[model samples]
Target: MMEEDDDVTQGVLLRCLSLYSRGGGCKVGATTSDEFGEIVGKSYKPVCGAQDTSVDCFSYGVEKFRKKNNKKKNFQLQEPNHNNNEMHVFLPDDILEMCLMRLPLTSLMNSRLVCKKWRSLTTTTRFMQMRRDGYYPSPWLFLFGTVKDGFCSRDIHAFDVSFNKWHKIEAEVLKGRFSFSVTSVHDNIYLVGGCSILGKMDRNSSKTHRGVLVFSPMTKSWHKVASMKHARSKPVLGVYKVNSNHLTIKSQHNNFFRTRQRIGGVSDVYEDPHRLSVRRVSRTSFEDQKSKQSKVNKSVKDCRRFLIIAAGGFGSWDEPLDSCEIYDSSSNKWTEIQQLPVDFGVVCSAVVCNGIFYVYSESNKLAAYDIGLGYWARVQTTPPPPQVHEYTPRLVSCDDRQLFMVSVSWCEGDGEIGRRNKAVRKLWELDFEYLTWNEVCVHPDAPMDWNSVFVADKNLIFGVEMFKIFGQVLEFLTMCDVSDPKMNWVHVSKNQVAREMDVSSCVMKSMAVVHL
Candidate 1:
C-alpha cells in the first residue's frame, strides 16, 4: 500500500510537470502514459488515481496520495514536508530566473531574501540587463515634494506603472535641501544646484552650492560628483552629445554677434534678430578669466560621449544670470559655454532632443540651441494657446523622433460669459524640420491642477496632481500611452503615504521616471 501511494504521488508530480512543460495544453485524463512520456521527454508509468484531481507541484510538495474507495481512488497534494527529501524538486537556474523576471519590482525585491542564490542571481548585472532588455518591468514615476519648512522631505514616493502601486523611498540625501533642479540621465536621478540649509532654527545659514548629487534606483544609494565652477540656483539642466570635432575654442565665439561695442559702460555683443545680445565685461573677474583661460587651454582629453548642460539661473547675488556651462563626463569638469540671450526671461522649462537644447522662457518664447553648431536660434513657430502660463507648458521628447508640448488653459464657464470655470489641457507636436507646431490631442479628463508631468521610456506620459482636502494633502497619478490613437488618460491610485500624513503645507517640487 505504501509503494502504491508513492507511485501515485510520483505520477501526479510528473503529470504536473508535463502540464507546465506543454504550456497547459496537455489534459490530465486525456494524456496517456505514452503521450505524457513524449511531453516530458521521459518514460513513466501511470498510476491509478482520480482523473479530476489537480495539484500545484511548483508551490507545494506532495505529502501522500490517499485512497478514497475500493473502485475509485482520489489523489491529494498537501503542505510540503521539509523532512521528506524524496518529494523535493529542483528547477534549473535559467528557468528560475525566467520566473523571477516576471514578478513585479516590489515582489522581486522581497524575493532577494528568499535565499543566497536568489539574492545573488537578482543582483547580477547580466540579469538586470536581461530583464531590462526583455521589457519585463514598466517605468516607475518618482515624485518629490517640499514642506513649509523650506526643506525637501526625506520621504519620496514612487509609483509602479505595472501594478499601479506606490512605494516609499527614503532619500536622506535630499534632506535640508531646497530650490534644486532634478533631471535624469540614463535612468539615474540627478539633483543639481540647490541651497543647503544646515540648521532648522537658523535661516541665515542657508548657502547655495554647485554640488551635484546622483541617486541610483537600482542600488538605492546616493553619491556626489565633482562640483560645478559657478554655483547656481534652479538652473536649466539638460543632456546632449558633444562631438570631439566641435570642442574647438573658436566655436564658442558669439556666432550670432553682428557687432561688438560698448553699451551702458559695459562691452556688449549684439545680435540682429530680436535685438538679443550678451554683455561682455571690460575687465574680467577672476572666475571669468579662469573660464576664458580654460576655454583656450582645455584640450579634448578623451573621446567625449555626453555632456550635462546648465544654463540661465539666479546667481549668488539674487540676480538673474545669462551665463551657461557644460559638464563633460569624460573629464569630470564644467566648462563655460555661450551665454543665453540677454533679457531671456527666467527659463521655465527645458529639454534636449536631436542634439538641440530647447528652452521655454517665462515670456512664452521658445528658443533652440544647436550643440554641434554652438549657436542659439529663436524658434518662430505658431504661438502657443492663449493665456498659457510659463510653468504650465511641459516639453517632452517621444520615441518617434518628435517633440511634444503639453499646456493647460482656462476656459470660461457656460453659465458666466467671462468667468473662467474649467481648465483645458492640450498637446502639440513640433515639426523640427520645418519649425512648425501641430495640435496632437486634447486630454479632457486630466486633473485640473497638475503639479508635474513627465515622459518615461519615450512612450508613456505621467501626470501628477497634489491638493489639500480635509487638511491633508493627497497626490494623484494619471498616465497615458502616446502610441495609442485615442491617447486616453488612465488614473492611477492616490499615494498611500499622503493619506496617512498631513502634508498640507507641502508642495510638489519635481518628478522623474526611471526603470528598475
Candidate 2:
C-alpha cells in the first residue's frame, strides 16, 4: 500500500456490526453514515451515546471480545452467549472487496489470507481496481537465471517485486542456448539473444535466437513477440523511460508528468495517453522543429519510432566502440547510434546515477558515463589503494532520483588464490556528488562472502553461489534505503538480485546491466 498518510489521526473508520444486524461500527455517535477517507494508526477514541450508537457499541464490543478471545490458547468447550450481538457483519462480497482493494499493495497482499473471499478478491480482475486508480505500483525488476547446474543452459528466471519473489519463466530457446541478453520496455522484459537451438556456438555466433519474450506478473503469463533485427547473444541493452513531451523539451526543468510508453512496435514511436499520471502529449512533442518559420513535417504523423539504445559486448573493454544502437519500436528497426564513448569498459551492473553512468572495471577502476550527454569520464577519485579485482562489485543505487551514483563498492577481488592471508573487503559506497567512498560492514552475524546483490524497494539483499564463478547472473535486485550520507556502511551489507541475461531483473537487464 502507499506510505502512511500525512495526517496520522484521520484513518478509514470501518464499521463492524453483529452478523445478524448487518450494520457496521463507527467512531463518533453519528446519526447517519459518513465516508471514511484518512488512515489512522494508533488508539481510537470512544464517542458517547448519540442517535444510533450501535456502530460504536459494536466496535467496542468486538475489540474487547477479540482481546479476550486471544487469551484462550487451550482447546476447551466454552459457553456461548446467545445474546451476544457484537459479531462482525458481512457486507456484499463485491462492495467489501472494493473497499479491501483500496488498501495499499502491501496490506492487500497480507490480508489475502484472512479469508477465502479476501484471497479471491485480491487476485481477481474485479479486485484489480487498484491498478486502474493508479493505486498500484510501477513495474518491477525480474532477474533471470538457470536452475540446473552445468553450463547453465536455460532461460526462465524473473524476479517480481510485486510478489516479492523470483519466477522461473518458460522459454523456447535453441538447444544448449548457453547465453543470452535482455532489455525492458514498459512493463515487459524482452529476451533478445542466445545460442540459436540448431546453430553453431562459435564466437559471438549468429546462432543467437532472434525471438523476444515478454512477461507480466499482473497477469502472470508469458507471450512471445517480434524478434530483434539481428542475432546478438551478448549485446548490451538499456531501458529508457521517457515522457515524450518532457523528453522533447530535452531538459528536466519542465514540470511534466512521468509517462510510461505503451508497448510500441519495435519500429513505432511509443506513446500512451491512457497511462500518463497527468498532462497529455501535445502537438509540440511529435513535430520536428526544423525551423521557427516552417510548419513541422507530417511524416512523423504517419509513423513514429521510439528509441531503445543498445551497446557493447564480447570484446576488449578498451575496444574503440562507437556503434551505439536504438531499437525503433515503431519501425521494428534496430538503428545504431553513431558515436558512443569508447574508452570506458562498460559492464552490465553499471548505472547512470547523478547524471553519469558508474561502470566498474577489471582494472579495479570505476568508470562514469554521461547517459544524457553521451561522454565517458573516469571517476576522479583514486581506487582503493590495495587494488583488488577477483570479486565483483555490486552497484547499489542510492535514492535513485535521477540515476547518479550515491555510492559504489565491492566484495572480494581476484586476490592471489595460493597466497597467504588473503582478505578482500566486501562492500563500498561512493557518493558521486561528493566523491567519497565508505566501506560497508556486514552484520557480524551475517554471511561475509556476498556473491551478488542489487538495490530495489528501499532494501538490500545478498545472494549465494558456489565457487568463484559470478554464476552468470543477469541482474541482482533488492529494496534498500542506501542514500543517506551519514548512514554507516557497517549496516549497509546489501543486495537486491540475480537473473539471467535474457530476462532482465534490474534495468530489466538494462543495457548497462546486460552486456556491461
Candidate 3:
C-alpha cells in the first residue's frame, strides 16, 4: 500500500510540472489529496476556484520531503497553502534564490522582469556575492570604438562568452570624448586622459584633459573623479592594488639609516677631542624627523588603495613622452615616478600581474616595472620564429599569476614559385622566475590583422581581427581556451554594431574583459 501511494504522488508531481511548462494550471483531484498531503506535509491543502492560481508544486513538494526527512540543506520552503482547491504556492526567499542562481546570465537577467521580488532578490548584495563566489556566469568582453568624427562612440559592444552573443551598452558620458586610455579594475571601468571638445559650437577649440571618468556596471552610470596633473593622450594605463601586508617597515628603516650615515660621515671623520661638539645634533630636529617618518609609515600601512599607473603617452604637443606617473586613490593625487627606459620607445601594450606592470614597446622589447620596488628592468627572452615577419606582440595577464603573450606575424606560404603572404598568430606563456617563454599554441586560421587581444576569466583569450575588403573595414572575433588541450581557435561572430557603423571611418580603440 505504501509503494502504490508513493507512485501516485510521483505521478502527480510530474503532471504538475508538465502543466506548468505548457502554460496550463495544475489541478489535483480529491482522491490524491491524501498522497499529496503525505508528500507536502499534513498541512498541505488544495483550493478550487474560478480564478487560476499557479504554483511550482514540483519544488514545493521536494522541499517538504527534505524537511520531513531532516536532511540538512541551505534552503527551506514557506508556509503551506491552506485555502481553496487550486494550489497557490509561495516560495521562501532562500528557495527562490537557489532556483534563480542556477539560471544562465541571459535568463537570470530576464527573470528580473518577472516581478519586483525577484528583481530585488537578484540585485541584493548577498546574491551578487554568492554569484561571484560560485562563478554563476562567465566574464564579458567589452570593445570600445571611435566613429569617423573622432568622438568616442556611444554604442559599446559586449560579447558574452558563455552565450556567444553580443550585447550593446550605451555610454552617454563618453559620447563626446576621444583619445582616452581605457582600463578596468575590479568591477569599475576607468577612462583616463582624453581630449574633449570645449563646446558644441566651438569644435575647433578643443583641449586635452587629464580628467578621469569611471563607469560602474551595477549602477550603469558614469562619474568624474580626480584628474591627473599632466595631460596625456592614449597613455599606458594599469591598476595595482597595494595592501598593508605588502608594505614593510624594513625598507623604510634601511633608507632612514642610509640618510643618517650620509649626514654624519664628515662629522665622524672630525672626531676625537672635538667629536662631542661635531656629533651633537639638535634634539628638536631629531624629534621632528622621527615624528614625520612615523606619520608617513602609519598612513601607508593603515589604508589599502589601488594605484593607477599612467606611463608613456603623447604630451600636449603630440610628442611621445617617457615620463610616468602614479595615481593614489587614498590621497587622490598623481605623483611622478621613474620614467620609462629611453630605449623602450612607445608602449604598445601593458598589463599588471602580481603587482608588477609589464609593458611591450614598438621596439619589440618587453620590460617590467615593479610597483613595490620602484624599479624597471628589461625582460630577456628568445626571438620570434625565423619564418615570422612583421611580428607584433601583445601581453595578457591571467588569474593574477600567469602571464601570456600573443603575437601576430606575417609569413610566406609555400607556392610553386610565387609565395603568398598569410598572417600567423602564436601564443606563449612567460615563466617570470626564469624570464623564459614557452610556446602554448598556434592559431590555424589567423585573420589578416589583429586589433587587440584580451583575457577573460578561466584563461580564455579573445582576439579582435580587422581587415579591409572593397575599401571597407570589417572586424571578427576569435577565441581560444588555454586550459583546453586541443587549444584550437574558434571563430565567434562579428560585432553587429560594427556592421551598422561607418566601417571606413570606424577605429577600434580598446578591448577589456569585466564581470557584470
Per-candidate TM vs. native?
0.67, 0.48, 0.67
- Per-residue lDDT tens digits of candidate 1, residues 287-399? 47647755764664533366788888776765777777777777677777677766677776778875578887777778877665565656767655554472357777776
- When sorted by lDDT, best at the front, the candidate numbers are 3, 1, 2
Backbone clash count for every predicted candidate, in the order shown: 0, 77, 8
Q: Give the per-residue lDDT of model 3 (tens digit) for 436-502.
A: 6888888875546545545545477787766666666667788887778988888876744454445
lDDT of 2 by residue, 1-516 (tens): 222231121322122211113232222222221211111234222212222322333232233212223231221233468554343223455555545544433333434433344455567754554444544443344445333333333444343333344324344542355445655444345665554433433334334455566654444457865565455555545444432322321121221111122224331211211112121344353233324323333323322224455455433222323344445565555543333334545454454343334555445556543444433345545445343344445554433432322222333444857655434433455643344565554322222333333433333322332222255443223233345444333322123223222222222122212100
Ten residues in a row with the worst lDDT in model 2? 507-516
Local distance difference test scores for all models: 0.60, 0.38, 0.61
Q: Pick the candidate with the highest lDDT.
A: 3
Cα lDDT over the full model 2: 0.38
Return the TM-score for candidate 1, rounded to 2 decimals: 0.67
